[model samples]
Target chain A: MSTVRVVCQQLAPRLGETEHNRNLGARAINDAAMLGAQVVVLPELMQSGYVFKDRQEAFELSEALDGPTLSLWKSLAAELDIIIVGGFCERLDDGQVANSAALVEPEGRLTVYRKAHLWNREKLIFTPGTAPPPVVQTAVGRIAMVICYDLELPEWVRLPALAGAELLCAPVNWPDAPRPASERPGEIVRVQANAAVNRMFIAACDRHGEERGIDWVGGSVIVDADGYPQAGGNAHRHEQRLVADLPLAQARDKYISAHNHVHQDRRPGLYLPSP
Target chain B: MSTVRVVCQQLAPRLGETEHNRNLGARAINDAAMLGAQVVVLPELMQSGYVFKDRQEAFELSEALDGPTLSLWKSLAAELDIIIVGGFCERLDDGQVANSAALVEPEGRLTVYRKAHLWNREKLIFTPGTAPPPVVQTAVGRIAMVICYDLELPEWVRLPALAGAELLCAPVNWPDAPRPASERPGEIVRVQANAAVNRMFIAACDRHGEERGIDWVGGSVIVDADGYPQAGGNAHRHEQRLVADLPLAQARDKYISAHNHVHQDRRPGLYLPSP
Candidate 1:
């Protein structure tokens, strides 16, 4: 099995600016493709920037499945022969909006996963999706998509991992927070932990720049199966592109030691049925 | 509620030296109490050391709940008016041996937890526990114990978190593995993630020393609710004592943001019933 070249394009998105954000996403994807990225990921809400003032504003900024941003992404995936995974604000029926991610394969297949676990004021603005994260089989590998806060939930990440996902691509808008002077951002740390525990590769794309008085960590990272970052594991706080060659086949081998396999060692019956 | 002073004594235990191990445990407990630690944590297999040659050797080193090491710990807890948590080789029914940890309270209450998930060669020697980790309400806080590799499973960690454990004390004997020079150990990273996701405090005590040609990670850490290490988050391969005054009350408030509580935000209905 060969390695897959994955890229995370971290860029700043203007609030409520649909066209500008679409252009930004396009440029990033083009840059990543130029850098030989077989799979490219963008930050969450790449279509309509994060931090909406209210539900009405979010709904107004949301777009349908066939919206211009997704259409452009599909066209780019086909034209560049690269898998495109990105986040968008979705306009659902009944006047509700959802924070969602779209994974577009070069073959023109599109799979969308709505944010299942809402964060902060998202609970007030967007209707949370009750479905699990989707793991799609692309030409490169078995890739999965989840939004920002969804990565915080290990059980949620386990869904795709258990479903045989080799790579989990997370589009995150990590609001900047105080951490130790010499420490990595907690958001990136959690991503590393998630990947390491499941023996899966994870690429998390975080946005930068201040939007409506809110800042981001801008901590994009591409971690291998062993949970070490191959590229971009710091809080650079700027528009940056991270690329890494991941042996997705390493994720297929669940064993970490001679007597232990990451997945098969789980004693699910011992876990509480519900929390 | 006031802060609880916790200590993780990362020490070495010589294999098959029962008497010497007991003396080492006693000295560590006394030293921790002298440093004003309300709760003390010790490494896994602290009583008999890790890396048994075979099942017979492990059984020979195993002890019951009334064994000398635990008896000494009980005396220390009562005498110093502090809680003590540590691991030991447990002798079980049917001529079996198990890797277990004991949480001894100042009130003379003893709670034992067998490791549910074995690591590497341990699968060949010990019987895996069928029960979940035990959470005990001590005078300082609601403390829980789970040995070594059990911490790798998010589901297992969630059991104690959901059971209202404020502080989870882990006795881990992490074997040294090749990691990036600048990156933190994956074991420590997972501990941070577990604490952050559950909004709980975790003190994992790891050992150091070369045992039967197997070196240990000696990465002991005390992490707060936000998953930042309060003390001793490094690969210090020697005898070290990590102390941190944890505001256990912070764990009670599970809210990371105004609209999100870590536990309440969980969508259990969507997760796979068994995996």
Candidate 2:
């Protein structure tokens, strides 16, 4: 069984507290590595926090991709022999900010992905990513990523799946939609459905606590190839770290039944490309 | 308000009892129409029954596209001034069989769609559909149909959504997976997730009762534009009929928030067509 240990760290990073957030992230990474996790994922904008008040506040909180945060994660990855994925506010050279996430490898190699689909107020704060997240080959599996609201688009996940992605990492700051407390949030449903369709593993790391007035729904989940929750599906409103063994190779075998291969059964002749 | 009342009929069809099954379906349609439903959906293979004993048995039960079942539905659709969508075992021209569904309109125009993805024993018995379901403009909304396991594919649902479909009719025979009876079935999660992602109404009609030792999970659901269950979510093991006002135009809008229009914000440059 070529199972890879995956971890999803659900932490509440205080707004504008970059140093404190960085410290929190370091502690989470260390804890996960000690637990034998080879891949550790963190929530969106954990270094700078989500829910910015205005443009000036967001600009002040944002930093370049080569800034202290990615460098710190890169060093930690090299030391621990782990792969880390996390989100941060990226300050661009052209005075624009991007809601970005990074994948840092054990060899200190780094690749950055900007959020392609921005949620509500994020449109006012950040530029939408021009390119999709790259799929990179790793010891764990062929891994790809989508940030926060990007998971809402079925096409975003399918793209990576077609490109041979076995695992999808989502760094999210999911706000609770108005619904009964007993129900699993819509975000959890999204991951489960997408995982089943793509026949892939998904590690969704979400934040907890209220960011400004917005309450984050802390249901960080790791779903297997069948869309069944492997660990910590309903994390609820608290700090939690979920780790599970994900069989990355099963995702490559798209055949669920004898005849139907998920991507192969697709009817492209009937579908038009999105504008 | 351009609200269209829709109904989902969750009725179990006894194996080989074709006439009885049609009667049961007729009764459900009458009930839905009494509740002022303009569109009514029924379970997969409700007329012929699912779980055939062998290839010979399945062939014996299969009927042509212009068979009595669709003829009956067409008469009822025109008589009641409603749209009907239901599944049947289809006997093809070259002696092949397809697990297919038909959408019968108020004008008595019939459109047929074969199930694109077959589950379990179905793969051995039926051919997978070559074309995706087509979206048709109607009084209720622009509607599309998929049968049973076809809903498992995100691409199948997305195809019709891109073509301006406001309503997706999923007629299914959802067998219960090995899980605790208390937990919501995975099939319900699939419809909810797909509905939420596509920003469209999904009326998923599922059968109940144990057919040939396979217990059907009867959680027929109607999800609105926001993916919230309008009615009959978790409709335990029994016969059920669900009716709800579906705001069809809301699906056309596709606007989740002021900044993000679901389909318009899609990044096609990053995505390749499904093979």
Candidate 3:
């Protein structure tokens, strides 16, 4: 069934400490590699934490796509011979910063995606990227990357699936808002909903531990193509690494058999633009 | 702040038996009245089970809006002095049948909402309703009714909210699907998402119990205006009712304070319809 081991690391990072965050990221990668994970994912804005008091603070944390942070990831990917996906703040030449994710291959090849959907406070610091994310062909399988709020939008996942992605990777830093226990199930439900609707494996990695007085809800999960969660992090815990074997063939089977190919069903003529 | 009590009834019907179903509906109404619920909601297609085998079976189950089903509900609402929201199969003059819900006031006044979004099997038996579900002003509050599939679409809920619906009553008969214990949190999550996004109290009534060998995943919930599930139905049991006292004023406060109005922020000029 072409099973591949994947790990979602719910690593907590100290704010504004790039070097410490890089070390933490490396440690997570090393641990997952030791456990035989072919691919590993980390949370959004891992290097800078999520809460920024101001736009200038967020901009100060931004780095070029090929900057030192990515160079460190490339080295780790090459040393571990594993695929690594993680989030970072991207500083563009035009003086704009964006919430972005990077996918580093074993050969040190890197592909970056800027977050398209910006959440509250994020709009102040990051400019939404215009380009759609591409599903790159990797040695393990075809994978796509999305950042935080982007995962909440259906089109973000759907477009990648349409572009031939078998697996969707999301790195998130979800803020803890006080919610009743009855409302706790929403995260898994949304993941499964996305997985089933797209007919693809989803490795959604979320941040854990409190930083800057804001608690990040870390419940990283690996959802199957059939919308079933295979493994990963849970609420109330942080700094945990979840590893599981995901079958590529089973995902393909589900896509071929059950997916109605909603794209094919699209009657463009009947659709009116939102207004 | 205004306070409103909402009851979401996850009711089940005896397949093909209107009399038995009517009795069950009346009993639930009586119980909700005793609990001091201002608004009581029943599931979609409460008079007949969700699955009716074939078109002929569905045709036989169809009744006019003012037929025996409405008459019974009217009397019950008046006797209890409570607002009752329930679903029925409406037979039109043109011989077309629609999956619909009716809002019956304490004085026996009724406003019917035809199902807008039809599911897979329903499309085979019923024609889509032409008019949008209108929000009806009541003694307790302004209420709106929507059938099962309508809840899945965000616009369906948003339109009513804009039309002055402080409370959204959704009558659903969701089929039981296999879910891991860990995934149980998904129900609460969806409820929270809906409540949070809409900024309105949601009384989601789902059919409970097994009928024709199909299990109904009963997680009927009463979500507060802030998206917190105040009362929830047990998934393992059948024929359960969830009663909760909801404060309408508190909902308005939360919605206004969040300033996260999806409808207001919608860039209608840029978006396309969902496929």
**DockQ leader:** 1
Regions of model 3 farther than 4 Å from truth? A107-109, A154-165, A181-189, A196-200, A226-228, A248-275, B107-109, B130-133, B153-164, B185-189, B250-275
Report the Cα interface RMSD of each model, rounded to 1 decimal.
1.8, 2.9, 5.2
Docking class of 2: medium
lDDT of each: 0.92, 0.87, 0.75
Q: Model 1: residues >4 Å from true position, as ranges? A: A273-275, B273-275
The TM-score of candidate 3 is: 0.86
Ranking by lDDT: 1, 2, 3
Error of 2 at B262 (Å): 1.0
**Count of backbone collisions in candidate 2:** 0
Tens digits of per-residue lDDT, candidate 1, B1-275, equal 58999999999999999899999989999999999999999999999999899999999999999988888898999999989999999999877999999999989999999999999989999999998887788898899998889989998999999998999999999999999998899899999999999999999999998999999898999999999999999999999999999999889999888988998888887888344
- Please give the distance, in angstroms, between residue B171's alpha carbon in candidate 1 and its true position after superposition: 0.7
A44-70 in candidate 3: lDDT tens per residue?
A: 998777787877887788788777888
lDDT of 3 by residue, B147-170 (tens): 876665444566676666778898
- Which prediction has more favorable DockQ, 2 or 3? 2
Misplaced by over 4 Å in model 2 are A53-57, A273-275, B53-59, B120-124, B180-182, B273-275
DockQ, candidate 2, vs. native dimer = 0.52
Fraction of native Cα-Cα interface contacts (under 8 Å, chains A and B) also present in model 1:
0.77
- Which digits, one per residue and each the tens of the lDDT, describe model 1 over residues A128-232? 998888778888889998998998899999999999899999999999988889888888888998898899999999999898899998899999888889999
Proportion of native contacts kept per candidate: 0.77, 0.56, 0.10
